[model samples]
Target: MPFALYLLGLAVFAQGTSEFMLSGLGPEIAAEMGVSLAAAGALTSAFAVGMVVGAPLMAALSLRWSRRGALLGFLGVFLAVHVVGAVTGSFTVLLVSRAVGALANAGFLAVALATATGMVASDAKGRATSALLGGVTLACIVGVPAGAVIGQLWGWRAAFWAVALLSLPAFAGILHSVPKGAAGGPGVRGELAALRSGRLRLTLLWGALVNGATFCTFTYLAPLATEVAGLGTGGVPVVLALFGVGSFVGVAMGGRIADVRPVPLLVGGGVALCAGWVLFALAAGEPAVALVLVLVQGALSFGVGSTLISQALYAAPGAPALAGGFATAAFNVGAALGPWAGGVAIGAGLGFRSPPVVSAGLVAIALVTAGMGRRVWRERVGSVSTGAQDK
Candidate 1:
């Protein structure tokens, strides 16, 4: 793997920290800005919405630009926006800054995905992608917690400043490592044409469903740990950290083998994830069991989830940039829908355990989708081979 790939991952780590640290600083932000908690939470929603919308749009717009230019521009925007967010006193300003920062983050991620895979052999796309995405898992383990601690000690604004500061190293590294005049994409039109493929569409759906199931349980893990598993508030962080560690392990292991055995990783990981969720639901009352299951769930969720992007890239050979954007959009869609589904289940009085059940259903649907996608892929390959033989 190229050292540039790890630098890109470092950039992702900075962006991801900003993305997730908001959760812990919500109360401080609300109080400081004199807004309701719900309003503060909307800041996160704004970021998510930006990420979903910005990925493909930015990828298309930047298709003609050099890859190095696009990445540096996005990182600069991200760094500037965080600085604005840090200094802004108005909640509206902060909200807008968060959204804009997310736009930059999404664009950077899309380009980085393309750039990373381009640097590797065709067979090692999965490993390259996992190397890039490992940043997010690292953020979950280190950055978010550190941000929370910073916010607790200083203020929410300090966390924003910290993100800005973190971004500086990434910006410098990307500037030094990524070559000048690196091509962005084939063209916007070619990218759009690639999106019409049925196999690509199914691959995106698979990504969304798998990510949705993962986030569904993750979003509600805190409540389940406390109300159901009888853990204190202090234990919640421990549980989350454990999950983060497991996810890191999963991504690392998956990266090593995913390119070689994509099907087994997805199918086996999906089945194990479903079973893990079911067991988590059943064992929610047992604190020890629940904690152990969270770790297992994280491993299964990420191990499978990490492959979807590589699959998307493979399915859309003509649109590497847009494929990265599509993968980003799919994961965000899942991230949004998963929590919403879990929320609905909880609101319906299904209890905290209901989220895991909902997750199980989502995983099952994802597995079925994966199966259908596999058939589609095989058919496409067969038809192409037949045409070649006739020629």
Candidate 2:
């Protein structure tokens, strides 16, 4: 792997920490803001929404500059947004800070992907992507829980400061380490042309559904650990850490098969996820079973994430740069939807475990959607073959 890739991973780790740290801070934020827990939960939704909007918008905007410069600009915006967040005592300001910070975070992530692939040799692209993704998974495994502990001991505002501190070096690294010639492409108009493809749209939908299925349950893991699984407060962090480990494992495992067997892998991932979540709901009363299910669920869900993304890109009929933007936005839109809907389920007295069941249902729906797309693909293939024979 290139040295620059590692620097990019470090940047990813910092940004991911900021993005997911909110998960552990949910209840604390609710109490501090004097709002319903559901309201504070919306903080996650707000960030997700920002990513949904920001990824494409920022990617489009970055086309005017070198990819390295674009990434640096976004990182600066990311750091500056956190400064406002760190200083704010108001709930409204906090929410706004999260959303704005996420916009910068989204743009940074979009360009960072471009830069990572550009930084490395062709054969090293896979390793580079894995490292960038690993940083994110490692952040989840380590950073979010640590941020939770920070919130538990000092205050949530302090967590923002920590993210800012982490981001500074990443900014400096991009400035110094990322060489010139990291140029942009044909821009958003080319990407928008992908809208003409029905298949690509479905693929993007698949991306959203996969992320929705994951976030629906994962978002409320803190409450589920305490309320449903009957873990003590201390155990909440332990379970979360384990979940992150599972995610890391999944990311590693997913990369292996994502290219060779994308459809089957996608189907298998969906089935495994649905089964895991259903089993989790059924076995919620058993602490040991619940814990195992939690970890395995993470693996099954994310293990094919890269493949699904690659598939989306392969299917896309637009600019390659926008391919990532499309896939990312799809997931974040689902990310936004998952928590908002989970909050609704909780508000309806469905309880924390209900979200997994909801996730299962969403996965099932995604599977059906996949089946439909597959059938269409086969028919298209058949039509082309028959036309060739006639010719």
Candidate 3:
């Protein structure tokens, strides 16, 4: 609702665009570089691995700087990396660019999320977080299409050039929107303590599993659609776009629901997510059903975005930045693992349908984990409340 929110959202849009652009450009890069598709796909995976490595590293480094400076610095790095990607003809050079870009991009998002949480009221945190992540949802729908077209029309190199150009706007937006003195205080010790706590550990584990299920299915959807669902090349992007639309809608609803009952919403969403995957496995055999199920799965999978974020923040109120960073890192770890595992399943002659079923099973695990997590968190909160009332 605030103007700062819009600028932050734009920054996220740019980041999301840059993060996902590789997926669309993978085949082009593979063909251009005379590498196999598997190797080209590794370009995308490299980014996720970078995120896992970069999130904590940059979060630690950023303790010395203001949030504004940290955000700006990362964006600058992101811009430069894209430029490098554009100019590099060597596959190794492109890999370096992607890795650097991924690292900077992860830090940028971690800081942006920490900044966003501080900008809003305690009650509006979930909604604010949702609005921020909604940019990513939009990017998946719009930015991917734009990147695909650019890669198709000019060159994949040109697509990277376009992303590089966006860093200028992202820098300008962050400088303009984020207040000069709005930086949060450092809490490296507190964050470490929180991470060591059982509650936080459980939450992260649940988040990782849930994320793995969702991303695994999504990462391979394009190939799966073509090989298993019998969808044509033209239809794959449409399905991906439809999935993005579902994500946008889910995040909006998740934001509102989280404000009322964050824990329950998370648990319910996990259940729905698992159900969506099951539906996907069954529906993949039917073109119409597959389309509908993909959209449903998208919404169900992403519906808990704000809730999961809010849960992590609440779990570690003393270390919001670290919590945010940890959540981001855990998510990417899932993203990395999901596709790799799905690829293995496909390579094993299980067929494309096997991955979605496997993903559903993972979601089912997350559902059970969410239930236990909610119970534990609720009991702890209740105990604290009782102690306060007695005192």
Candidate 4:
């Protein structure tokens, strides 16, 4: 909608790069830090855990800060942590830095979503959320790969440095453009009280489940392509690129349809996401087919993701700030859990394809959750209208 919303998206790109670039930098960090790759992988896990808890923690802690101030505060922490990480030689310190950085990233994103939504008409929430999330998609397409290359050419620290440098412009843009919008919804007590809503909780669960579905399959995508689809290591990025392309397409289309038909987008996208995973697993041996499925799966993933964000804002229209933070924490919880679940399946000899099966179940849950929430929400609204008419 506004130029500031685009600025928020760019800020998202800066933070999101760190979220994914570490996936490709594990080996380098492991070697440099003299830790096992498993321990290095734990650094990524710490970031996810921080993100999973960050927003709620911030919402509870910083109930009085202006949206613009909160955004800048998070970015400042993120930038400083990245700089510290870039210069650090201690593995443990790096781990701590990653966690703090993720916390800041989560806070920034939650506020950004709330602020963006507040800027637009109620009907345009989807487009606003999508616009902000487009940063993550662009990072998937560009930043993560570029960071991988930077890591290989220079070092993992160099990638962190690059991210830190990028944060400068994002911080300036946010500071210059983002208004000090009044916080939406309730304060700390209000957020806690609002959590009691079954409908709100259901929406949060749906957010988590949908993300879990995507990550469950996505965690094993590289192995699936190499072992089952018969692709070389180099081809892995190509598959990821295809997924990114689909994400871009999905988010763009979802932005257009979300305000007009949020339920259908969530329902149909969730269903399509499940089917895509099933077909992907079945076509694991067919490289072309698997590649095509990657694109479709990516599209469905973001289409559903955008809908969840839109629904979160609409469902808790009174408390955009708190609802936004809570929704983010919910999604990241799923993001953290999905990979763990997939790893469990693979560990049990279910193979790479098993991940998609696991993901399919998650999507099914999300679909059911959405259906239940929609029904309950509609009934609640109808009751309110009936009460008003009687009065």
TM-score of candidate 3 to 2 decimals: 0.91
Instruction: List per-prediction Cα lDDT, in the order shown.
Output: 0.88, 0.76, 0.77, 0.83
150-192, model 1: which lDDT tens digit per residue?
9999998899889889888888888888889788878998788
Off by over 4 Å in 3: 31-39, 194-196, 379-391
Q: Mind sharing the TM-score for model 1?
A: 0.96
lDDT of 4 by residue, 1-391 (tens): 8998998888799899999999899998999889999999998889988888888777555567888888888889999999999999999899999999998988888888878988897667888889989999999999999999999999999999999999898889888887656553467777665455566678788889889988888878899999999998988999999989899888889888887777667777788888888888888899999999999999999888877877777766666777788888998888889999999999999898999999999988877766656656443422312221121
> All candidates' TM-scores?
0.96, 0.86, 0.91, 0.94
lDDT of 4: 0.83
Clashing pairs in 4: 185-318, 185-319
Which consecutive 10 residues in model 4 have the weakest lDDT in total? 382-391
lDDT of 3 at 1: 59
Q: Candidate 2 on 256-281: residue-level lDDT in tens?
A: 65544555677778888888889988
Worst 10 residues of 2 by lDDT: 382-391
